[model samples]
Structures are given as structure tokens and as C-alpha cells.
Target: MSKVVLVTGGSSGIGKSICDHLSGQGFIVYGTSRNPDSLNTPELPYTLLKLDVVDEENAKQVVKSIVDREGKIDVLINNAGVGITGPVEETPNSEIQKAFNTNFFGPINLMKAAMPYMRDQRKGLIINITSIAGYMGLPYRGIYCATKGALALVSESMQLEAHEFGIDICNLAPGDFNTNIASGRYHAPILEDSAYSRNYEQVLYVVNKQMDDAEDPAQMGIVVEKIIRKKNRKMHYRVGAFMEKFSIRLKQILPDKVFNKLLLNHYKL
Candidate 1:
């Protein structure tokens, strides 16, 4: 039987690419977005389902509906995420909540919702779209990084525990993808003359200046599709330019002080 694949946040960017890649691979693809009308899928072989991952009931209902129609879900890609950038102190509590809800809890809820069907079949693949931020902390992205860091741990624990059920969880760490995700970032609540104002300005300046230089999201789709199709997969896939590899390796090999120096110099801190 052809595999049934579902991608959350599939209306655009990396998620859309994943949906297209899997559909091309002959999987019956279904996609979910909070705003279903955001997608224009006249050409893609995908069915779009309305889902707001932060809503537990809504998340579960989407999974249940898919299972009801397909009889099984062979793959679930938790690709929905949002980026909120600012100095940690200046970012509002509501913004922090929004970040965690979409980035961390959203994926977790989806996993919980889909687990029953996967556990019943004793097989499944769960792919998480994490970031290099999870591996190493970045200045001004404290909340955003925290969400991905938590997700990294979540993915790790899930991999260890879910293997017995014949399930696999992979955390994909992509650096600087050329996606509208950055352009689509929710701006931090602005406060002029605040102590953190300068830092916030500096953060957004750095982010805005570099976002256009990020890698293409389609390549992310290709990498993910390969992992999904593989019989055995690694726990993590680190991707991006020379800078990304160097960053990940430096964080792994260098002492904190040394790595911090490089990071500061890289962003001219």
C-alpha cells in the first residue's frame, strides 16, 4: 500500500516542499495549516486539512480524520513553527507563550495525537524541523532557541522510548534556510526608550540583514524526503552552508569561551 504522509504547516516554505516531494514519491499526501486558505494547491497532489497545533482537540481531530480516511498514517512531519526575535528581557510574556506554543508544544501535541495510530501499527516516522539554534544558543534569539532546544530534547527522548514500538523520530537541524519564515516573524512588542531597545534594534538589524542570504527551503524538502524514504535514519541531520557546518563543529569541538569568541566575531558583537 502507498504510504500516507501528513505535514503540519504545509501551506508554504519547507512544509510545502515536503508535501510535494512525498507526493512525487507516490505517497498519499495530506497537509494542514492554521489558515487553510493560505495554500494554493491547484497543482500539488495534497489534501489540506485545517489544524491549529496548539489546540489539543483540533490537533487530535485532524489526526483522527486522516486515520479514518487512510486507515494508517505512515509519516508525520511536525514542520509548523514561528520565529520571534528580540532581547529576552524586552520580549513580552505573551510573545514568549506564542513562541513556545507554536514551536515546542505544537509538535509535542501533534506527536501525542498521532501516537495512537502509529503505536497500533507498530511503525511510523516522525520528523521534527528543528534549527541550529537548538544545538547552540544565539544572542537575541533566546526564546526562539529555547523552544527548539526543548524540542531537540523531546525528539531525543521520543527516539529512545518510541523505538520499541517500531517508531523513529528524527530532528532535522537546518541552518539559514531561505524561507519566508524570517520575513514572517512576529515582531516583538516595541517599546521606545526601553533599556533593551538598543539590543532589540541590533537583533532585528542583524536578522534582517542576513535573512535574504539564507539557503533555499526546497533543499530542506529533498533532505527530509530522503530521510523518510530510508529504512534506517540518523537521529539528526545538520544542513546548510560552510558556515553552518563550521558553527556546529565549533560548538562540538571548541570550549565555551573559544566558541563564544567566534560567535561574537561572526556577528560582529
Candidate 2:
């Protein structure tokens, strides 16, 4: 029997690539978008389900609907996330809350909804698409980093807890991918008199340039496919650009002052 795979935020970018790649591998893939009817991506070969991960009730309904139709969900990929960029002090609580709602809590809700089914089956895979930013704070994107960092921590605990149930939870952190995330990031208002206004623009400019030069999203799809085929997968996997993938290792070995300086230099701070 084919495995039933669910991928959120599948209308485009990495999610779309993953869905297409998995479907091509013969898995029964179902991708979700807030408005499936509005998506015109005919080249994507997978079932389209309506889902808004930020809504707890809606998330449960979508999971239940998938279970009803597919009988079991073998894999759940939490690829849905949003980006927010700005100085932490200037970023409004509301904007932070919105980013958390979509990036952190959203994946948590979907996992909560799907775990029972996974536990019952005694075998499943849960992949949370985090970011290399989760490993450290970034200038003008601290909040975004915080959200992914929180999810990465939770995923660690989840791996231990779910192991007894024959379920695997992995945090897949990618550095920078050629996706539409840059254009979609929420920017905190920079008032004319704001102290960080000038710095914010420069930081945002660098961030955008890095994103523009990011690796292809298809690379993530290939990595995910390999992960899915593994009998015993690692709890954490880091993909993407060379420095971004190596940064995690560097952080562990380098002194705080040195690592911090390198980070600042990379972002031109």
C-alpha cells in the first residue's frame, strides 16, 4: 500500500517541490493550501486539501478528513511557515504573535491533531521544516529565529516521547532556499523617527540579496526524499548553502565572542 503523506503550504515553493517529489515516488501525497481552488499549479501531481494551519479547529478537521479518506497518514511534513523581519524592539507584539501563530504554533497544532492517528498506527514520520536561523539569532529577524528555535527545541522532546510509539520526529533545518519567502516576509513598520530605521533597511537589503542567491528548493525535495527512504533517520538534518549548514557545527566549537563576530560580519553588522 502507498504511504499517505500530508504537506502543508504546498501551493508553492519548498512545499510544492516536496509534494511533487514524493508523489513522483509513488506515495499518496496530499498538499494543503488555505484556498486550494485559487491555486493554478496544474503541474503539481497530488491531492489538494484546504487547510489553514494557524486555526486549531481547521487543522483538526483537515487531519480527520485525510484520515477518513486515506485510512492513515504515514507522514506529516510541517512545511508551512511565515517570515518576519525587523529590529526586535521596534517589531510590534502583534506582528510577533502573527509570526508565531503561523510558524511555531501552527506546526504544533497539526502535530497534536495527527499524533493520535500516528500513535495508533505504531509507525509514522513527522518532519518540521525549520531554518538555520533556528540555530542562532539573526539581525532584524530575531523573532523569526525565535519561532523556529522554539519549534526545534520542541521537536527534540517530541522525538524522545514519540520513539516508544514507533513514530519518528525530525527537525529539518535549511539555510537559505530559492523561494518566495523573502517577498512574503512581514516587515515591522519603520517610523521616520525610529532609531533603527536606517539599520533596518540595510539589514533587510542584505537579507534579500542572500535569499536571491539561495539554493534551489528542489534540493530540499531531494534531501527529503532520501530521508523518507531511510529506515533509521537522524533526529535533526541541516541542508542548504555551505556556510549555513556548517554554521551549526561552528557555533558548537567556537567561543561566543568569535562566533558572534563571524555572524555579525556575515550580515555586515
Candidate 3:
């Protein structure tokens, strides 16, 4: 039987690509939007479910609805996330909380909601869409890095915990991808009087340019398909341009000060 897949944030960007690809490949795909009714398009390759990942009860109900309808859910792609950028010192606490709620707690709640069904099935897969940014702290994006980094680590632990129950949890961190994330991301205002103003503005420009020139988000869909097909999967995977993937390795091997210097120079800080 083809796998029944549930993907969050499937209305656009990486999630849409994943949903379209999986549905085309014969998987029963259910993509999610916060307000599915508001979307004008009535036809898509896959079904769209209503979901607000931050809502705990909503998350649980979505899972139940899927299981109740399909009678089984073989895969859950925790692809819902938001981008946030700003100096750590100047960014508001509320904005930081919102980012964490969407990028961090949202994924956790979905996992919590879906795990019991997966445990009962004794065979399930979850692929978390993290980011290359998670591997290191970058200028003006410290909190964004922190949120993804925390999720990456938590996935590590969750995989271990879920293994005994016959479920596999994995993280797939993509580098810059051409997507709507750039437009949707929260960018803290560049205040002229703040100490971080000049540096923050410079770094933010670089970050935005990177997103503008990023490769296709469709590549992420391709990677997710490969992960789903694999029987023996790694605890984590990364997809990006050669240098983007290489940067993760550089962080693993480079001395702290040297790596920090490289980042500062790269961002022209």
C-alpha cells in the first residue's frame, strides 16, 4: 500500500514542493494551511487540511482526523516554520517568543500529537525540516539559529527515544532555498541609534541577498522523497549547494575563533 503522508505548512514554499512531489508519486498526501478556505485555488495535486501548528488541540485533532480518515499515517513531515532575523540584543522578546513557538514548539507539539499513533502502528517516519543555519550562529540571526539548533538536538534525542517503539525521527537541514520565506520572515528594524544598527543592516542585506539567489525549494521535495524511500535512514540529513553543505563540515572541524572570524568577514561585519 502507498504510504499516507501528512505535511504541515504545505500551502507554499518547501512544503508545497514536498506535497506536490509526494502526491505525484502515488502517496496519499495531505498538505496543511492555516486557513485552507481562504486559498482561492480549488484544485491541487494533494488535499489541503487546516492546521495551526502552535495550537496544541488543533494539532492533535488534525492527526486524529487523518488517522480516522485514512486509517493509517505512514509519514509526517514537520515542515512548518517561520524565519526571523535581527540582532539578539535588540530583538523584542515577543518576536523571539513567536519564532520559538512556530519553529520550535510547533514541531514539538505535532510530534507529541502524532507519536502515540506512530507508536501504535509500530512503524512510522518523521522528517523535520530544519536549516543549515542551525549548525552555527550567524550575525543578526542568532535567535533563528538558536531555534533551529535546539530543534536539531531535540530530534537527536527523540530519534533515540522513538527507536524502541519502531518509529524513526530524522532532521533534514536545507541551506538557502528560493522561497517565500524571505518575504514572510520577521526582520527587526535597523535602528540608527542602536549599537548594532550599522552592522545589523549590513548583515541583514547579505542574508536577504542569499535568499534571493537561493536554489529551488523543489530540491527539498526531491530530498524528502529520497528520505521516505530509504529503509535505513541516518539520524540527520542536509541539502544545499556545495559550499552550504561544506560550511557545516567546516564548523565541525574549524577552531572557534577562526570560524567566527570567517563568518564576520563573509558578512562584511
For residues 121-222, could you state the per-residue lDDT of candidate 3 as single tens digits? 999999999999999998888999999999999999999999999999999999998889878899999888999998988998787788767989889888
Give the per-residue lDDT digits (tens) of candidate 1, residues 1-269.
Answer: 99898899988888888888788878899988888876555766788889999999998999999999989998999999999887788788999999999999999999999988999999999999899888888888888889998999999999999999999999998888767797678777557977767766776777777776888878887898789879989998888888876788889899999999987776666
**Model 1: ten consecutive residues of lowest lDDT:** 36-45
Error of 3 at 226 (Å): 0.7
Who wins the lDDT comparison?
3
Q: Residue 212: error of model 3 in Å?
A: 3.1
- Overall lDDT per candidate, in order of appearance: 0.87, 0.91, 0.93
Q: Which sections of candidate 1 miss by over 4 Å?
A: 38-43, 189-192
Q: Is candidate 1 or candidate 2 better by TM-score?
A: 2
TM-score of 3: 0.98
Better of 2 and 3 by TM-score: 3
lDDT of 2 by residue, 85-144 (tens): 988998889999999999999999999999999999999999999999999988888999
Structural similarity to truth (TM-score) of each candidate: 0.94, 0.97, 0.98
